[model samples]
Target chain A: MKFLSNLINGISLGSVYAIIALGYTMVYGIARMLNFAHGDVIMVGAYICFFAIYSFNLNPVIGILMAVVVCTVLGVVIEKLAYKPLRQATSLAVLITAIGVSYFLQNMAQLLWSANPKVFPTIINGSIKLFGGELSISRTTIVIVLVCALIVVGLSIFVNHTKMGKAMRACSEDKEAAQLMGINVNKTISMTFAIGSALAAIAGVLMCCAYPNLQPTTGSMPGIKAFTAAVFGGIGSIPGAFIGGILLGVLEILGSAYISTELKDAIVFLALIIVLLVKPTGILGKKIHEKV
Target chain B: MAAMLEVNDINVYYGSIHAIKGVSFEVNEGEIISLIGANGAGKTTTLHTISGLLKSTTGSMSFMGTDLMKTPADKIVSLGLAHVPEGRRIFQGMDVEENLDMGAFTQPKSSIKGNKEIVFEHFPRLKERRHQIAGTLSGGEQQMLAMGRAMMSNPKLLMLDEPSMGLAPILVDEIFEIIKALNKAGTTILLVEQNAQMALSIASRGYVLETGRVVLEDEAKNLLNNDSIRKAYLGG
Candidate 1:
């Protein structure tokens, strides 16, 4: 029973990681730049939701939607303002710029909302009882899992079918070739950041619901972990992010439950090392398939 | 035949290195113009400059009277210019059909299907491998895919850069035939190749680029039979 409960909680947590990891991977795929500020986007998302619901007294759903919109705009703006000019700059320059953006967001949040952790309300509080409540699943957990599934599904369809999505993939594959094909690389990049940040917002709100704390640094840990998930799954592949997140989540939870709790974080990193040692290209990373 | 593309003393640089110096050429409507040169002769650079991939330092490139310097690289395709760049720059990861779809990316969705079928007709091998990744296709097939991809846009001016870089002799002949056929079907062509003999055979007008300048420009037959041209380029 304890194992099963841990498994459920692990999935709940993994889904959140998957949502966040999707943003990291997608932004990396299109922009060819690692957006270290993605985690801070989650912080911005959480604060927006908190302010909308608590300060403005808006409906929780609308608050979440507004958070998505604001994060989307923030993401596009950040890309244009901070990243666009450095499109041709060296990777080191871009990396430092991303870190600078992350710090700027963190410090700005601290100034606006204060460093003290805000107590986020339990928007959805209920549980599904199983085995006479001995085994229980929270409604929030179920919602997070379902919503993450929807996002993954919806994103897959969009990337595989839509025109803009095709352009994104093409641009990611070959920017010069895509441009010659008449794809507006700038617009495609903006759309990619917008989508990634919107997913970040979803993960952020769901995370706040799970933890019920809205601090300026609330998004840092999850952001780092989700980035791990992306690297573990093969950074550019979408399904890799999903599977890597869930696997990492389960490993962390199971390690905590079965092994020492003090070493749970270490276990996750240890598992990532083992996976890399064996495959090096995450689970489904783009591999050199032919004898070219 | 009206001049579809006109270049006037354009200079292009790779960083501080002046790659193309005082190069001038013109392509007429429905004519095949070939730029033949040795390695490092600015053949690819010239094609790239006209495609807006590289900007000229101090000269003019006009396609159908629109200044190419002002247009963004992505918008060059919409201006009735299709450039099949060196090494067959097809999206290697995308499938054959998806690549053709990308070729017609500027065209409306309703027209993509029809454009794709036309491309397949031009290269039956592409039809067979519509679902196969482009990287997996043979060198000859990839070259065909590149040409067919350029055809998807149905541009007024089709520019090919080293379309026969690494293909069998028979495949080279096959590719030139298609290039000739496309020209006969009313598409103007600007071909750049190191294969001077075959390139000059089919070209209506020929320009020999050496050290970033047009060393000679004349009707293809005249250049083909010229004593110095035959000595240097045709292996004497």
Candidate 2:
């Protein structure tokens, strides 16, 4: 029964990681860039949600929506301001810029929201009982799962069917050729960041609901975990990121149960290292052949 | 016949390397213009400059009366110029259908279906492997896919940068045949090739570029008979 409860908890938590991982995967796929500031964007989203719920006394759903919109706008602005100029620059320069942006956002968050953790008002305070061993599923878990599933389905359809999605895939595969095809690479890259950040924001709100705590640095662990998931499942593959997140979540929970809670993070890192060592291209990632 | 595309004294550079220096050429409407040269003779650079991939530092380039120098690479396609870049830059991760769809990025939503059918008709192999990931395709198949993808844009001018690069001899002949057919279909072509023999044979007009300068420009047969061109590039 305890194991079942842990399993459920792990799944719910893993769903949150998956939500954040989507942002990482989408942005990485499109730009071939690792936006290190993505984690800070998640933190920003949580704080935005926190303010909306606490200060304005808005409904949780409305707050989440507003947070997503705000985060998306911020994402676009960041791309224009920090990334656009560096588009033609070297990979190292772009990477350094990303790290700088991450640090700046973290510090800005600290300045605005303060360093200490603030308790978020839980919309789903109570727990529900399930069959057999009476699994305790919170409203927060349900919301997280529903949101994650909806985003995944929505993203899948968007990438596979829509014109914009096709453009994005083209840009991801070959930016220069995509441009020659008349797909605006800049606009597509901006859209990628916007979607990625918006998803991160939603994950933030969901994380707040589940844990009911907000901090300036709240996005760090989740961000690293999500990044790990992205790499584990193949950084550029969306579906791969989803599966990686869920697997990571399950592993963490199982580790905590059988092993020590202190070693859970270490175990996840160990798994990441082992997987990368075994399959450098990842399980779902395709091997790329560069023409000589 | 009025020139459809004109390059007037254009100068292009790659860092410190002065690639295309004062290079000039003109392609009349419905003509196949081949720019043949050695490896570092700015053949690819000229094609790239005209396609808006690399902006020339000096001189002017125009396509169908529109100024191409000021235009962005993405907008160049909408202006009816399709560039099949060097090394067949196909979307490796995308399937054939998706890659073809990308070519129609600037086209109206209504015309995509029609254009796609036309592309598939030209390259039946692409249609057969429509769902297969592009990276998995063989070298010749990838080249075919690249050409098919460019065709989906329905361009007035098709700029091919070494389409025959890394292909079997039989495949090369087949590719040249397709290029000829496409030219006959009224698409103005700017072909950059290291295979001077095949290029001069198919091209109505030819330009020989030597170290970023236009050393020779004449009718295809004239260049085939040129002493310097035959000795150096055409292999006698």
Candidate 3:
């Protein structure tokens, strides 16, 4: 029963990681650059939620909406201003630019909101009784898991069934060929950034409900962990990110419960090292050898 | 007749190295024009330049009365221009059907059903492997898939670069046959090939490019019968 409770908690935590990981994976798959700013995008999202809810006195749903809108626009602007010009530059140049953007976003958030942590209101209040309230689950955990699942399903359908989605896949496969096929590669890339950032918004709001705390750096730890999840699942593979996030979440929770509370983060990183050393491509990732 | 595609005094350079120097040519409507040259002789570069893949420094390229110089590469496809690039750059990760879907990306949903049927008729092998991953197909099948994909757009002008590269002799013959058939069906063709003999056989007219310059241009039979062309390109 305790094991089941830990499993559910792990799943909920992992769902948050998976939400963040999707942003990293989709952008990386299409643009072929690790978007280091993705983690900070989550911070921006959380700040937006705080502004809309606490300052403006809007409803929780409305706050989430604003967060999504702001993060999506922010993502598109960043892509156009920073990443677009560097498309033809070397990977190292692009990597450094991404790191620069990440740092820039972090600093901007820190400057805007200051370094102190703020208390976040619970969006989804109350816990449900399971096994006569002995192993009850929090509303936040259920909401996170269900929301992540919905987004994941929606993403797969969008990618595999829609025209724009097919264009995205084609762009990832061969950008040059996609261009010849009349796909507006720029539009496709922008859309990818938009969707990834939109998901980050929801993940950010859900994160506030779970942790009930908002800080400029709160997103950094989860963002990095989710990136590790993406790599663990196979960087560009969608299901891989989902599965990797869940596994990482469960293991971290279970490890903390059974082993050492303080060593939970260390255990997660250790697992990442082990998985990478063994599989290299993550669990579901396909080997992407550079085409000659 | 007015030219459907015109390239005037085009000079393309690759980072200080002049690749296509003052190259000029024209393709009239409903004509098969072949540009035959050896490797690195600027044949592919010319095709890339014309299709907006590579921008020329000082030249004017107009297609269907549209100034190609200002248009981006992705936008060029919707202007009834398609390039079946060298190396058959098919989306290897996608299935055959998905590849065809991408080819018809710019078209309205209502047209794809018909266009796909036409492509399947042109290359039944692609239809046979419609659900199979494109990379798993044989080299010959991949070539056919590439051509089929190009055809999906129903372009007024179709450009092919080395369609016969690394294919079996029989497959090469089959590819040329398809090229001729497509030309007969009213699509203007600009073919770049090292297989000069095969390219010249079906083309209405031909240009022999030597080091980024058009040294020879004549009707198909005249160029085919020329002793200089025969010695240099046909390997007589």
Per-residue CA lDDT of candidate 2, range B51-164, in tens? 788989889888888999999888998888899988999988788888888888888879889988888777888889999989889988899889988988898889999989
Preferred candidate (DockQ higher): 1 or 3: 3
List model 3 lDDT by residue over A1-292, tens digit each. 9999999999999999999999999999999988988888988998999888899999988999999999999999999999999989999999999889988988888898998889997778799998887899988899899999999999999999998889999999889899999888899999999999999888888888888788888788888899999999999889998999999999999999999999999999999999989999999988644332
CAPRI grade, predicted model 3 = medium
Q: Write the per-residue lDDT of candidate 1 for residues A40-68, one digit (tens) a residue.
A: 99999999999999999999999999999
List ranges where model 2 is wrong by over 4 Å.
A290-292
TM-score of each: 0.98, 0.97, 0.97
Interface DockQ per candidate: 0.63, 0.77, 0.66
For residues B1-236, write the lDDT of model 1, one tens digit per residue.
44789998999998889999999999988899999999999999999898888899888888998999889999999888999989887878888888888888898778888878877777899999999998899989988988888888878889999888888899998899999888888889999999999999999999999989999999999999999998888998
- The pairs that clash in candidate 1 are none
What does fnat come to for each candidate? 0.65, 0.87, 0.74
Cα lDDT tens digits, model 3, B160-208, are 9999998999999988989888988989999999999999999999998
Q: How far is B161's C-alpha from truth in model 2 (Å)?
A: 1.4
lDDT of each: 0.91, 0.89, 0.91
Residue pairs clashing in model 2 are: none
